[model samples]
Target: MNFNEFELHEDVLNAVDSMNYQAATPIQEQAIPIILKGGDLLACAQTGTGKTAAYLIPILDKVAHEPHQHTAALILVPTRELAVQIDQQIQGLGYFVGATSIAVYGGNKGPEWDQQKKALSQGADIIIATPGRLIAHLQLGYVKFDQIKHLVLDEADRMLDMGFLGDIMKIMSFLPSPKQTLMFSATMPHKIGDLAKRILNDPQEVRLAVSRPAERIDQQFYMAGDNQKLPLLSHLLTQVSDTSMVLFTSRKNTVEPIVRALRKLGLKANGISSDSDQGEREQVLRSFKNREFPVLVATDVLSRGIDIDNLSHVVNYDVPRDPEDYVHRIGRTARAASKGTAITFINEADQKYVLKIERLFEKEVEKRTIPEELGLGSSPVFNARRSSGGGGHRDRGPRKGPSAEGQGNAGSKKPFRRKKPRSKSAAKAPSSTPTNSAS
Candidate 1:
């Protein structure tokens, strides 16, 4: 069905037209009407399904009609990235409607928020914030929720995964008891179910489906040795040059090395991990969006709520630990109803996970062997897949990297270096006769 059939407010329709969105996705079509009716909602939709617009459009309608003197709505998201993305969506939908919104999250200084808090105190329409930052504002007496008519919990499963349930409950307590509450997530774990039971009142439950990704994506897999995975990925990047791609690794330590390797190969790549500075992460995201950087390598922390429209490719460099993460990882592409591609690198060690993932989809993933010209040895064991990427971290200063345990000599302590030679002059004469210590 076309968007005109919904008979939404002119403002929302105008926003939709501005975005050139001709039709709504299944989840958006199902949930938007329910949300517009001002009823409590429990929506389960996979990532990249336009879930943000499903709620944002309806909330904007509510805001445009029922003008209030206080904060009218609160959207609590799992991460600062999601919070900012949602805020951007809300603003885009409400741009001509004169609706105002602010994003609140940690890592950003309060100076920028000070002005927003002042405007909000005077009366803000919407607030999209992370739970911790939102509660911090509340504790500082910078926000009041006397007029919160709509409350949204975006990415509820991730919030539970991040152990923010207590903060969510606390924030819920401060809002008016009788309000329209909405919870949206890709998967509804037992904890999310319990939280919904407590928070939602006779909510309309909407589940698009389980284990379904956008049909426009062509999913493929590559079987290679673990040691060859990075080189293979490097090869693929060269083969598919100039496409905006997202590459996912399983661990945080793996990100930097892969990024460095990609850069060394003269490809524009940035790493996103838990330890990355928030400002740098934001810049990486913005650059990726602008096509200034064509590739972003990240962990599952970015699996959901990273809404880059028309993202053409997603690569699974490492199989995700959570089977659900596999769905979200590939979902990054094929967004906003556009066709895309998803490729996964599977080595022998990943064999155990292959079946579990296949069970989730109720079918075997089509496996294709890498070209023999790559020279990865045959019948490789999983341990051969145990490590990938450059092994050492570049220290920023004089401090040594973390030392290995039980490896240091008793008389002399030196961190293990994988490649540097051990000089007999420095080692043999070190303990007994230290002539002079460097000042």
Candidate 2:
């Protein structure tokens, strides 16, 4: 459907047109009218499906046409990067409508905090924040949301996964009751439903089919040992003509080492993780987007909500435990109907996780043999059932040697130890991921 069909404010439509948005995505088509009608909504759509614009457009329209002296909308996202991305989108779409927005997130120095304070106190038309930082502001008794008309939980499941449920509920207490609440998620788990029950008031539901990797994405898997991964990745990188690639590792510590190894092999690569300060993270992302570097090595921190268009390839340096994350990682590529490639490195211990990923894809992913020219030795056999007992080393803990980053010599022998699942109590602890505020 076209933006005109929504009957949005003229200024809002003008902004959309200026941005060259020709048609509404599936989520926008189903959810915008309900939001325009002042009804709460629960929407589930895949990443890169224009989910941000789906909610941002109607909110901008309301702020344009409605009378409001205080903040009109509060959008809580799971990461600082997403908060910034959404705020930038609002700037573009809200330009002609004169809607103001502020992104409140953690991991910044003093100046950012003061700016956020000023925006909150002065009532920016919209506030996009990570839960942790917003809570810190609220605790100071300076932030007010008594007049907030719309509350949106973008990536609701991710917030829950990061143990932000308590923080989210706390933030909601500051908002006025009976406001329109919108919950948007890439996937729906039972926890999301429970969250909706507590927060949304008879919300309308819009669920698109879970997105599969685009057919244009050429997915390939390689069986390698931990030590062989780095060399294999280096070999693969040399063969690909497109250097716009992202290498995703599950643990933050592996980021720098991997980048260093790739650079030593004469590849233009950079790394970012939670350990990197907010400014550094932003800079690295900007550089990567500008193609200053051909490869970006990062943790799951970049797995969701960080948009870099025209990405040609995604390398899963480590298999993500959750099948959905695997989708999100590769979804970084093959965007906007573009063709791309996704490569996954599977060690003996990661085979089980690969099985889970393949199940999500509803078919067996093609496995390729490691290039023998590299002399990386025999690859680990693909035996998910036998490896189901958890024989791989969890990508946590202190790094000691070159092998710690999967860059050791091909013959290096690192013992595999089973990683225990986090207990329920441990799982509920505040996330150490950079996205959450210290509060």
Candidate 3:
């Protein structure tokens, strides 16, 4: 559906046109009319489904048509990255409609706190905030929400995962009752349903299918030992052409070490984690977006809502503990129907996690053999049962080959060959159970 079919305000349509948005995404097509009609909504949409614009455009239209004295909409997100991203989108979509907004997040200096105070005490048309920072401002008793007509909890499952339920409830205490509430979550766990029951008032629900990785994403898995993984990664990177990649590690401490290793290999790379200050994190993200570097080594903090376009590849330096996160990590690539690649490095301990990921995908991801030239050692064969018990099969020992030293330019070597494509019957294995939507 086109944005025009929704009968949005003329100025709002102008802004959408300027952004070059031609048609509404599935979530946007279903959610916009409900939001414009002033009804509460509970939408199940994954990342990259245009859920931000789905909520923002209608809210901007309402703000354009109606007069308000205090802040009008409150969008609570899980991370500072997402808070900033949504605020940026609002600036683009709300431009012609003259909507004012601010992103309220933590980890900044005192000046940021003061600025947030001014916006909250007076009013911005929209306030996008992380729960912790917003709660800090609220505790000072200066923030006001009496006039907030719209309340949206985006990525509700993630916020709950990060243990923000208490803070979210406390934040809700300050808002007026009988307002429109919209909750969008990627997964529908019981806790999400429980929270929705308490907060939402007879909301219309929209559930999209569980989003699989885009067909354009070529998913590949490699079985390697912990010691051999880095050499293997260096080898693989050399095989690809100039590419934009985000390498996700589950641990923050490993981010710098991996970055240093890549840099020593003569690859331009940078690292970011929670330990990095807010300004530095923003700068790193900005530089990566501007193509200042080809690889960004980060923790799962960048996995969820940070939008970097044209990402050619995603490398899972470590498999995520949660199966759903594997989806979000690779979902960064193959965005907007574009082709991309997702590569995962699985050590012995992480083999079981791969099994869970395959269950989620409903098909086995292709596993590749390590290049013989690196010759770090014999790689562990995948055995789900043994790996599930935290044990892996014994290796035969190191194979004879050149050391990782001075082998950084392996791209000039023979290109790595992938396994042949699987048959359609094997790829389309049917599920015995029905898929359930997030409640």
Candidate 4:
């Protein structure tokens, strides 16, 4: 349905029009009404489904109508990039209504901390935060949540996977006894259901397609040996000019080498991983988005939540061990009804991972043989059409069950909360709170 049919506040309608948003996504259409009615909701939606706007539009509409100066709505996200993106969307959608929001996350200097502190104290209408930094502010003691009317856990499944359950529970403890809680997760693993049981009060559910890559993505794989993977990558990019792409490697150490190799071959490339600080990561992403760089080599840290408009392709430089991660990586391309290409490099080392990825999709991914000029023939390791479902050197015994990160008990106990470091050296140094903290 068109957003106009929802008869959202006139101000919101104007902002939507200005933003050129013509229709609500399925998730948005299902979610906005329940949210506007102040009902608790548990929504199962993937990254490309416009989940951000589903929550933001309704919350912004409420904030505009009710006119609260106190932090009216609080949104928790998994990454620094997500917090920034959500805050930016809040601005774009809430523009005509003049709604205000502050993104709260670590990886900032004293000035950012000061600015966040001021907004929290003076009551910004909406606060988008990572779990750790908000806990740090709560420890500082002037922060407010008692008046927060709405609470949203965007990417709730991701937060639990990152081990932020403990932090999320602790944050909830600071909110008033009665408040509206909404959860948006890409998938509902049992732990997510457990989290919903604890935080939501009789919430309605919206479950669309989940844990699958968008159909618009053109999926293909290249069978290459260790010596030929780099050449295959270069061949793929060289075949196209000025393509915006994100290449994912399994380890941070692999990122730089791949980026340098790509640059040596005359592609504009940059790399991002855990080793990069928040500011550097943001700058790299900004440059990648601006087309200042045509290729970005990133680790799984960029797999999930960074929003890049019109991204043309994604390359899995190293196979992801988890099927879910494979979905998330390809998801970076083919977003929001746009078609794009996803390529994977499969060596003998990557065969088992590829099998699992195929199992998740219930079909084999088409495999492209490395050209003779690239120094490899078709992979002899496994037949692409008829994989034993068990290829590679080592036997992958059996899939392990969910780990402690996916356990409900992880949320029951409170973890010790540390105050932000104070000594000058400690304060200035870039540090990380738990990756799951408020993710």
> Ten consecutive residues with minimal summed lDDT in candidate 4?
430-439
Which candidate has the top score in TM-score?
A: 2
Superior candidate under lDDT, 1 versus 4:
4
lDDT of model 3 at position 297 = 89
For 383-424, candidate 1 gives per-residue lDDT tens digits of 322333322232222121111111111001111111121111
Task: Select the stronger candidate by TM-score from 2 and 4.
Answer: 2
Ranking by TM-score, best first?
A: 2, 3, 4, 1
What's each prediction's TM-score?
0.83, 0.89, 0.88, 0.86
List clash counts for every candidate, in order. Answer: 1, 0, 1, 3
Ranked by TM-score, the better of candidates 1 and 3 is 3
Model 2 TM-score relative to the real fold: 0.89
Evaluate residue 173 in candidate 2 and report its C-alpha lDDT on the 0 to 100 scale: 84
Candidate 4, residues 339-401: lDDT per residue as tens digits?
999998776656777788888888877777866664434554555444455543542321222
lDDT of 4: 0.76
